[model samples]
Target: MREHLEGVRLGGEMEEPRIRRAAPYRRIAELREDEEWVKVMGVVVEKKDSEIVLDDGSGLLTVFSDKEGMFEEIGVGSQIRVFGRPMLSVGKEMKAEIVQKVDGLDFELYWKVMEEVKRLEEEIR
Candidate 1:
């Protein structure tokens, strides 16, 4: 029993949530239901104490932070990347576990490569 408990503790410590790269807000808004551990990047359009709104040109969505001080430096017009599980109420909302400030994201180049990658993957399939 003692050995079993130690193994369980070690397993719990080693199992961490997989944080994935954020998708465009357009994709998020189109989701039919809850998705696990999603991330999104956008400009901060609105902010309160624990919640913030981001618009990535595709759409605007709200991300809520559970950590009190996580949003301290976040403000309007700041670009950020946020990770959470997004769910829809009246609209799409996310309870974010991680929020990161970002700069110099080459969106144009990134999208172009994404398009090419998709095309290749489709052809292979």
Candidate 2:
């Protein structure tokens, strides 16, 4: 028998699903306006009090967060990955939800792998 979540209330309603969709990994230049979630890997070229400028070779993008401790371990020249929601109202930027350091990623190899993954996904569709 499976457990039921009928009594569960999300924001006083029981309609919310328990799963979150995965954010797609994308290069800075390929991000689309319609995408709700996105993941990007880049070098932290510049970091401020609330934002960091990331360069993924394809382009430069600003990733910001108002939440505390989000940029604690991040520093200039640090290679990191950011998962966030894009905010295109002003310029090329995103409201970061998660930021993680990537210690030894080889961008050349990573790019090749992503290209192959995209090709496979296209074939499946």
Best by lDDT: 2
Worst 10 residues of 2 by lDDT: 1-10
Clashes of each: 1, 0
Regions of model 1 farther than 4 Å from truth: 1-27
- Show model 2 residue runs off by greater than 4 Å: 1-18
Give the alpha carbon lDDT tens digit for every residue of 15-117 in model 2: 7676768988999998877888999999999989899999999999999998987888999999999999887778889999999999689988998999999
Count of backbone collisions in candidate 1: 1
Tell me the tens digit of each residue's lDDT in model 1 across 1-125.
78767746443457678776655333444544546666677889999999998887667888887788988988898888887777776687888888999867775565577668767878999
